[model samples]
Target: MSLYSALYSGVSGLTAYSSALSAISDNITNVNTVGYKGTSTEFSTLVTESQTFARYSAGGVRAIPRTLVSRQGLLQSSSSPTDLSIDGAGFFVVRNSPSATAEGAVQFTRAGSFRPDAEGYLRNTSGNYLLGFPLQVDGSVTNTGNVTDLVPIRITELTGTAEATENIRIRANLQSSDPLIPSVVAGTYDVTNAANNVATGGVVPNFSRDIEVFDAQGGTHTLSVSFVKTATPNRWAVEVYAKPASDITTGAGLTAGQISRGTIAFNSDGSLDVANTTPALLDPLNIAWTNGASSSQISLNLGSDSNVDGLTQFDSVSTVISTSVDGAVFGNVTGVSIDRSGVVTTLFDNGLTRDVFKLPVATFQNPDGLTRLQGNAYGVSDFSGRYALVDAGTGGGGTISPSTLEASTVDLAAEFTNLITTQRAFSASTKVITTVDEILAELNQVI
Candidate 1:
């Protein structure tokens, strides 16, 4: 009976050590695998009955394999723009299907070696697509924590629509010492009048600047702002012309491809005095296009009425400090990149950038409790609890490191050490079986 027990114990030891060897082998094999987590074999004892003074019992061993999923892997620099890694806790959300609306199972992974397919869908080597929340034009996430709201990040479009110019902000200094233009009657100021031209025996403007504006069809047109000093102190007639005053000979009212005039009055301290000037002149000026393009309403922002945040009449040479207009021509998407906050920005050929999507990282209450799936991915289990999907670098989610990858967590030296110990234990267990068999054979011969 003792020999039979000894044989069973040796078999159990062999089985347990074999399982341990298998775990070690797996760890060593995946040393070069990206984002691979190692596994370890845990042993448990089996007992038949409680020990008593008159009786003795032997116990066998059982092996239980456990995955080291919570350990962090080293981050290595990568050349791809989409390659990403997490320095802290969290996993990149992914899906098996390529369709954005496909009702496929969601998975999580640490492998970040990603490349875009022909459809511009980012997928890893395992063929799982990266999932994220859609972004509005203002760079805000559409959905916060809902998993179902996540969609595949696709950038199939090659170009972005052109936008019309709406607002033009100009900051400049109008020389206060410049001579005033000869003033006619206040109501007789006509931009088309030949007398308005300073080049041909007419009143000369002290300063002028040219700006290009885009229409609804992205047609470019020149807008010229001329400042004429008036008889009133600290007041100047601001005239905007599409063509030079010398080119208009009809002396007719302003027409298409002509000019519009407004008046600006400044305070003694060089601040804008909107109360005394016509509000129509300070409002948005509509420009009619001769090229059949839609008329554009351009807001001329010189400065605030009571503040000197824009145009200033200083006692210096007239100079344009800065000018900015909000409009863009039709452009093709030239490239894409991700930031630390996981915003995927698409760069266009027209020097315009857009935030297309916000990549959200998913974290679990107990990451180690997750069930390991194929291709270095994990699935949610009952013990793992629910996943909390949050934007990257927010709500405890780790910041995404673009152009990097997570290396395997397996240590080759440690795995080799474990492999040697497991092999010795397996050999010792076989010896126990062999010795027990010899004793049993001798006892049978005597009988």
Candidate 2:
């Protein structure tokens, strides 16, 4: 009976060693796989009860394959900007289809060799589509902690964009030595129309400057701000009007291309005096574009109170210095970039960047317990706890390394050493099987 048990034990040894060899073979083959986790076979003894020490029951061996999914892999630079990697814990949530919303279809992976597909959806080589939270125009993301809230990151819809000018600041020196012209009204100056600007029969401004501003439609328009010395000391009447006169429909209190008319007062020290400045700086000037654009508002910012940073008045010759305006013309989408926090920003040729989506990193209680799936992905199992979606580099999640990929966890030297040991063990198991066979054959002959 003991001999019979020994024979069965030898068979178990052969099976266990075969399993170990298989695992080693796979490890050696997948040494270069991106985001690959190596699996190893662990052996355990299966013992049987024996009534007495003299009568010993041979024990068998069992092999268990364990995938080291949690072990981090080395990060390497990648040529593709969409290629992403996590430096620490968690995986990238992905799906099979861009339109998939089912919770069962959700999967997780560390393989970040992603690129935009034909439809502009980001997908990895494994055929799994990358999912992310859609960013609103205000740069806010609303996540319900559910897979349905995630969508495929498609960039093709963002073909082109235009930004309207909202704020403008002018910096220049107004001639303080210019004498107050009696012909120009002192207390209040009304620009009958922009035609008063020409040298013929109209009043010529002492100084004038032109600035370009972008409209809602990305159309460029030039605005001229003309200044005239007034009867009041240290005060000048200013009028802001658009060029070509026909570009904008005239509104009330606006004529001759004038959008706004106000008087600027300067302190005796050559600094701006805001309290005495009429019409207040930063007030929205509403205008209707004749070029079929919607009504838009533009805010003007003169300098701070008693600050010469903007609209300075000095004895120097008057000249237009510089202008700072926020806007961009219509532009084509150039490319996309991802920040360390996993925010995907769409870049345009007009030097504008818009946040498109935010990639979420998923974490689990037992990452090693995940079930291996196709495309270098993993599925949630009972052993692995429920997944939680977290912003990259937040809530203890791993920081996203843009334009990089994670190297496989396998080590060639180590795998080769394991391969040799497994081969030897497997050979020894064959010897055990053959010896048991010989013993059985002897018994058969004796019987």
Candidate 3:
């Protein structure tokens, strides 16, 4: 190769190195930036003729290319439920609504650091809505929808009278030895079904109880429950049958007949317990009786009970209790349940019911193939294929940790080393330019 060509090659090398230095510098600067991905340089030679050895400049600069592919660094756990980190593949989709235009509007992200917006929707620092399908009541995603289009996380107080509106769990031990026959005189073994509404007895002895309770609106509902005593020793099956109360004051037709009936076993101790049932229901409708309107009473008329040894008979039963049915009387959040699909639900002291939000997760055809969008976010691309919708901890997604967040994965020491290397390259490139100028000045002086 000619001397001039050799010189050009060196210059090109300097140019490429300088660009690489710049890219590395950029990476170092963002070392503390959450979800930032580092970039590297690439170079190739341009050969005019292979036969002419060293004839061409070390191929002028090839692309001082930015990397479109990178392995996401390991995730750091911030212990924040809202702080999310992708363990394997996929990106946290965020809508860049503020900066969006018709063309290439929504931007995806890797940063899981987010907070609730004023509207209670989860959004990133850029105010982008994280994308994913909203969970349905049945724990199913409706449209495989993206978050950018949906409303923010909803926040508001839910109100209602969580009365044993349906059926107050009835758990009580009817002693095996206790001679309690059905109400009728001739040892009523058979229970009479009146109006085809309440079932007297089947293979199992199941009964329904209707209680009149006022709602948050001071409206009464005729909550019915069906109880089934499974004949299983010390165990019974119970289910709730509920209907709004037509009226609460008059006990005329408000008998323990309208409630859907289920049976639960009472241990030998007479304490009602719902076994193998979640939230365990125990005792005569472990009635979580509430008066959403105000302190009220619902009758528990045993109607008639024939005792053992043919001795005792107890008829009428009734009681009054307070309710948290209105705003002034907010119910306490009680039990929190997560279904198999990771949908979180909160049971309140009040009777009102609701399914708050479904924990969402983004899955990719190839998680490793996802292109980093920085800020701990990833984007879908040809390499990423398509997104596979899923919920937390399912289909290779991470499980959610409520009240926690993920920390930054950046390592300060490693970033500093990279910074040093970039600085050296920058200096070397400047030296090359200086040397070139010096040589040109010498030639001009000699001429």
Using alpha carbons, what is the TM-score of model 1? Answer: 0.85
lDDT (C-alpha, whole model) for all candidates: 0.81, 0.85, 0.47
Q: What TM-score does structure 2 among the candidates reach?
A: 0.94
**Alpha-carbon runs more than 4 Å astray in model 1:** 50-57, 100-103, 144-146, 180-189, 192-204, 243-254, 258-260, 269-271, 287-296, 305-309
lDDT of 2 by residue, 198-309 (tens): 2212677888888898888899998877788887789888877778778888777566466777789999999999989986334787778899978779888788889889
- Comparing candidate 1 with candidate 3, which one achieves the higher lDDT? 1
Model 3 Cα lDDT, one tens digit per residue, 396-435: 7655444423333445676577568756865765676677
Q: How many residue pairs clash in each candidate?
A: 0, 2, 65
All candidates' TM-scores?
A: 0.85, 0.94, 0.57
Q: RMSD, each candidate, Å?
A: 4.1, 2.4, 10.3
Tell me the deviation in Å of residue 88 in model 3.
2.5
